[model samples]
Target: MNIRNEWVSFKIGDIYFPDPQQVAFERHKDDLLDGKVADLSDHGLLKEVFAVVEVEGIEQPVIVPVDRLSGPAPEMSAGEE
Candidate 1:
């Protein structure tokens, strides 16, 4: 088995969060643009997710992806090049 890291497990090396086809194709958004809210299921079971979250008061299933800006730590700021 491939010993992949925890962070990489949810991602298939793509920047996007693997959203539905409509958002992926219709929107023509970039992979790094992040993913939108979605209801995911597998084997007729609802899985629990900690990272992705739904919109507040939406009363609907949502699975939005988080966007992490690329930047070095404050201490390493000088090293950025």
Candidate 2:
């Protein structure tokens, strides 16, 4: 079994939290911007925003920003320098 560490806060390696206020922006948004907030989820954009993965040495799954993840290296073919 893989061992993992228990996180007490958002200060874990490469893991952080968005502004608390932003989390409930719908509640703190300006009246003028009412109904103007773009719902990225509507376009299925939310799926690419974050990735949940089990990292080695981590006790629990981590939610990391998708953009921060590096793509796998391209495979080299025979005779390819």
- Would you list the C-alpha lDDT of every candidate in the order shown? 0.40, 0.44
Q: Give the local distance difference test score of model 2.
A: 0.44
Model 1 / residue 40 / CA error / Å: 12
lDDT digits (tens) for residues 1-81 of candidate 1: 776764543333354655555544655555333223334334213334323334445465444322332333354456545
Q: In candidate 1, list every pair of residues with a backbone clash.
A: 37-63, 38-63
Q: Ten consecutive residues with minimal summed lDDT in candidate 1?
A: 64-73
Q: In model 1, which runs have C-alpha deviations exceeding 4 angstroms?
A: 1-50, 68-81
Best by TM-score: 2
TM-score of each: 0.17, 0.30
